[model samples]
Target: MSVRKQQLLKQHRRNKRIALLAIIMGLLLLGFIAPLWLLPLAVLLVWVVHEAWFADHLFYSPQDDYQYRFPDGVQPLSLRLVNGRLQLQESSLAQQATVIAKVQINSSWLGRWFDPSICIGNDQQTFERGAHGVRYLNLTGQVEALTTAGLAVQGRFCSIATQIQLYVFTQPSPTAGNMMILAPHADDAELAAFGLYSGANNVSIVTLTQGEVEAEYYQRLGLSQQHAAQLKGRLRAWDSMAIPLWGGVAQTHCVQLGYYCMQLPKMAKQPDVPFASQQSAEADIRTARRHNTIQLPGDATGLPTWQNLLADLAACLMHFKPDVLVMPHPEIDPHADHIATT
Candidate 1:
């Protein structure tokens, strides 16, 4: 017998012995109880005894070992139970790009209704039960990132194994063409389009908003007034640094439209809403009076109107005449500003 089967057999025998003892003890106690109540009490006692004895078996059972191998040149990924925990093992893909792992898990009979918590990659990812006790989770990060990155199921009633697959795509080479990246916020381009932005030859990043709404975030961190004033400058500096990081000799253009953050979706939807300045909410009331703003293209004013915003964006497109245009997905992206910009 396999090691897992041997363990299961030993556990089953132990539970059987405990259950038998509980039944005998229950019968002995029932002799002192009223004869009419004996049947109900006996049933309750037996259920409690059985549950205690077989609780561990509810999660684990002996099953045939399974192995999964990916196509040649692709990293092979495998799922297995090691010492009662579900784990994912993979052969290293000799690349420095990010890897996204897609995992799907299905529950057994009891777990279908009871459900359980499933963890992935050092508990970085967690999934609850879904309809029909099925759950899907996606984990994305740089290659060879985590030390204990794997899948784990946590529930006494859970008994199903996990399935996982990896996706890795090669980054395109830098070419001499105009590339425009439309970012809803200052950091959006850095987060979503860093890889693409770093590879493009002539790139123009248009930030729809100044991201001034992060004032609250800075306040929460107890930053001083001087530091807060320097926030926008720091962000602009970071944008300039991207050109050197990408090995691009040509200067990268950064266009900032100083629109209020957290209000883009509302303004985009209802164009008539009055514009609110993010500078009004400042840590030091004195510094809030000074407006150090970037110049917008097309001689655009700091207007919150959707028409002006569209016109400015149009002017940027016309000026750049980009061969490749990248913007956030409208419906799929969860951020309201991203959706509005898209």
Candidate 2:
């Protein structure tokens, strides 16, 4: 046997032993520590080793034939795994494996000794917010089969059905705080309806953080012929790498709420004093109109600053129906406007 093959064999055996030990120790530790915390890592290690063994075997033999299959309307994915880079592209819509793609990898010294990533685009959902789509993974034996076949894959493979709704607005606008829109935090009924809590495959909204999205990338997050053309060239798309455990997905409409929310003036010190006498109040309404602001009504109400601000806020909230409303407490800092708005 070649020296390289001999070395690979030894490494494979060692990995197997380590994986076995992890499983055994993890199970034993479950008695003392929370299984929820330790078991996932343990399982991940087992998967890594099992995949590594197969990958080495495949790497050692290039002549072994392989076949990739997919269901109808289901597209095969092209993944390139070179070093630590993972590139995934959607195959032709024909629903068959006609191309072999690789994922990119970045392997460091420590990674080589520990766990090295094989695939890069697993958790990627939509390319942009409000664009309804997801990269679906079929949890059949094929992925594991591929991993064992000497292809590098990271993490556990579970099958999930994916669908996405891309909501795009042709006219682009800036959002307040650069926060990505999120679905309203799920209520108990929503959780049940979406099967989120029950672990069923229902459509649950997820909101990526601000960093995950680039608003300038698309004219509107909604579907566009220009974007459609772009999709035509690419094989696959992935959501940017998000901190797997820290971020979540939610749906959001693109607009600035604070644009209107901030316009509300603080209540006057005397509740009975009408806002008509306040120069800031009159200027605020005019400024809002010139800016094409959606909140201010032209009908003049001779109410106090506080009353007028509250009425304006109520209207803005009703129109926006913000899933998460962000309001700054001016009272804490005591800005003249803040004091009045509060």
Candidate 3:
């Protein structure tokens, strides 16, 4: 299980204990104390019990508001804004980034039973920050939309200190990804699917149906079924979204390169872009260096030959001394070379 899930479970158990205590105390007071005091005590007990019994649901419910935090020095981030705009102060970020919170509400029968904190409401925000340092997310947006339903999400995170532009806006046509409406929707299967599309505007993202996912895989990674379902569903709903997530792209590669440099024994100075290259392979290498902080070969981690395919990476880092570095998550299945690089 993920550290987040474990923490959440711990918190849940604590809340449950608190609720049980409050109830017991309230009952005792009712039997032996004044009506006014006892009545207030009873009410408090009820509220606490409600929170404890339904903490998970209360958490994941759309109405609940939350903020994710990173301790000092954490890096990388996975952010989600459902019904709110995220305001980030680039300067306040520390070197490392960690997910301080994962809040949401799931209104499924099994969810409510297996995890009683399930409730029905219209707001949801999840945080998946990577790295091991602290960063800040300024939730300085309006809360009016958050109080309502029908998904509105905006997610962004730094891959290698350079933030890629990923915005999801709302439109009439369901702009971004393909939208899948759930038919005969059950509580466990209410959400269909949506795809992430390259629309004319930013908000062109899609929604997906739940049945079309391998939930267990993500669940094993400590993500809630709902969260994993949505991500996979979104991919299925969108065209070429899988490419960015799977294949290596220059921009994405650079992002990873920036992240890797930050961890080396010594960092490099940022590279200078001489000119744009027409060849993608050459261009990818060049662009990777251009935005990089460490100048060629200097920022790389391992020795040249030992690194093999990573020779270019080492060279890129050495040429461009970036403060941070990032690389794609090495694929563990079906591809040996990719896994080796990852």
Candidate 4:
């Protein structure tokens, strides 16, 4: 935030690749000109450059486990929801049992609302909202009498369940430790885990974007290009807010880096000349400024300059101080922002 820091940031942006390349080239030139006393130092300098910039780190530790696999002997369900209840792999339309979990209810019938109940044979458990994919709403009525016949599940309305797997609640796993999730785009975290973070005792979600996401559906609605882009970014920002609610995460725990994607290199090293012209696909500054909720840099106004996104991201890490981080695989993923998000 300081003026001096800002000036340094600009200088860093301007020389991201040039400084390293220049040093290496100079060292190589020196070695070629004189192969005696200065030659050894130049070769060492070149190796140092390679080691710092290109080579992989020598020290290593075992990677932490992020995904949770079901233990042996646990049955996972692929059920169909019809009328009011989940058919429990029934796959038929004959039954209309009770549905209690709030996630699958469709919630619209001319403003008619149904407070669905879960049947515990002798008594009924009443609930509203909550009970998403990973986070189960704990109810008192059905705590005791669970049997193979399965308690009846009823919903106010009907919705669909694509996949459902049940895991026994025990002490928290490694994932429950202090954790942080890094998302390159808006919904990437939810695409990976619906409510997994709800189980973690201490966790935070950090979404990185230049607000460059596209919402072509908005364009179809006849909005101008900039308007559509801003709307799309705000919609994703809304998504960031809603996800934490689903996982029982406090609203403050989620943060967005309102930093734009860096501009593409106008100058190349080995080539070092203006390359052939290409299409222009850039980060939407309009969209980034519109994104609400929690953002660290630029208040909410994002930029699209030629700077690395890491400085802002590093500030986020320092603030949260989480032990475990979930991020996109740099090599496996091909998106530039996705690669930088880690």
Q: Which candidate is the best by lDDT?
A: 1
Please write out the lDDT profile of model 3 over residues 1-342, one tens digit for every residue: 556657666776787889689777867767776666567667776777565545443223222344443344444434454234333334333323221323233233332333222111233332322211222332223222222331233332221122312222222344332222111111111122212222212211111111223546656767676566544433333322223232222222222221121112121221232111111112122222233333444234322122222344555444434432222234323223223333
Candidate 4 local distance difference test against the native: 0.50
Candidate 1 clashes between residue pairs 3 or more apart in a chain or in different chains = none
lDDT of 4 by residue, 26-93 (tens): 77777677766987776687678565543421221111112344456544434433443333334231
TM-scores of the candidates are 0.44, 0.21, 0.23, 0.41
For each candidate in the order shown, give its overall lDDT on alpha carbons. Answer: 0.55, 0.33, 0.32, 0.50
Maximum-TM-score candidate: 1
Tell me model 2's lDDT, rounded to 2 decimals: 0.33
Which tens-of-lDDT digit does each residue in 1-342 have in candidate 2?
A: 568668767876887788678778877787477757777776787678666644545224222222333334544344444543332332222322232332222334344334332232343211111111123223222333334333333522211112111111121112222222222111212322222212321112221111111223343557354343233212111121111112232222221111121223422454444433211223222322221235343326423345554454565456555444333355344433333333
Clash list (residue pairs), candidate 4: 98-153, 98-154, 99-153, 99-154, 99-155
Candidate 1, residues 1-342: lDDT per residue as tens digits? Answer: 457768777877887888688777877777767595676777887788556544444223523222333345756244444544444344454444445444444445554334344554445433332212333344434344332443443433444444444555444343357888888776677688887777776887777765564455555557654456357534543453343345352333666555556667777777755456455342221121122233334243445666667777887787778888889987558688888888
Task: Point out the worst 10-residue segment of candidate 1 by lDDT.
Answer: 283-292
The order by descending lDDT is 1, 4, 2, 3
Candidate 2 lDDT for residue 99? 25
Worst 10 residues of 2 by lDDT: 235-244
